[model samples]
Target: MDLMDLSHQNRINTQLSKQKVGKTIYTDCIRAENIKQIVPAITQCIECYPRFHRAENPDICIMVTGIPNVGKSSLINALRRMHLRKGKASRVGGEPGITRSVLSKIQVSENPLIYLLDTPGVLSPRIENVETGMKLALCGTILDHLVGEDIIADYLLYTLNNYPQHRYVQHYELEGPCDNIETLLKEIAKKLRKTQKVTAITGTGKFSEYPDGFLFH
Candidate 1:
């Protein structure tokens, strides 16, 4: 499907033509326009999905890192449906870091060679604040590049809480009830639906009405 088709399918309303922008070749254009609207966000995405270092022959690795149960697996599954491999990345569950020792890599294309890495949830880091900052920066960057700025920020808030002590929360001053991760996931789902232009308050209620195809195109 083209970009427009995907957006229509996902209910994302944007001016960019789906057919023209769907191709990976137009990613730079999307990034340029998006960065103009949200600078820090685009910068973050670039850092997260860094370009191949060696120009002669570079291997691109796109890392998908987020807190547990934040739909990371679901997103990967969706991507896999788009022809990407679902490497043996960690599975989603209440416990963090299920794929502790293994790194799941999905090969998107072979000619240029793109590898998408699903990393372990960022909870208690073996390192310190610096590592957390770097991860948060990369996460923000990736989200902004692919999704949007506000969505990325919201995701960051939801995921960073996975590591209660992560300095990103303090840096952003995100203060709220310390609800469970499930609550945050629901919130993300609700926001995602809204981003797709669905106007439903109770996310569960909307989800329950899936039979009517209320949200799906």
Candidate 2:
């Protein structure tokens, strides 16, 4: 969900484009303004409208599936808006698992009669690796607390460093790239004055203050 930055998204997509995906995955970047291309793309993908030669067959039911928080519902709604000029028929949210179950069919088009089946985002039972899981978490496919924000933030720091994207360092007014998560968090906390006071156990019948802020507030 943090893919709000178009440049960052384009860079990430460029890196992924270098890797292999299936036999030949067609690539296209459609912005919100280019909704016209969506219908053509779907219609051209033979898989989208298979053999329904019968005179009165049920309307084409297209099932949308993906990892959580990838905007499946929004896509359906957008297509509906473009084709049917209708309001949203499915719920859209900024978090994962917005659609809890298989939702009833919603018509998206009138001519060919396209009905979209909105299903809840499904994740594999087991993630391949920690980094893969971290990426999923960073993309909001997984809940933040499940992976721990500190770890995710640190991973973000590492990724930014690996990408040589020091725009953060300039934004935070830091001296330079920092490899230490705690040190970076400390510097950020101090700069933002975002510290929480709480008791910390010293394990010697005593306690100390605990800090509770990170990610530049």
Clashing pairs in 2: none
Per-model lDDT: 0.45, 0.77
Give the per-residue lDDT digits (tens) of candidate 2, residues 1-217. 3346555665666777688421222222235555566555555563444576456775567798888988888888877877887898999887887899999988988876778899999999999999999999988999888888999999999998998899978898999989999988888887788865567679897976655523344
Best model number under lDDT:
2
Alpha-carbon RMSD of each model: 18.3, 5.4
- Write down the worst ten-residue block by lDDT for model 1: 22-31
lDDT of 1 by residue, 1-217 (tens): 2123354544432333455432121121123342133223323444465463456756556776666434455444444433333442336553334546446576644434555677656654553664464454444322334444445455455566665646633443435534454444444455456323334346555433233233421
Per-residue error for 24 in candidate 2, Å, reads: 8.8
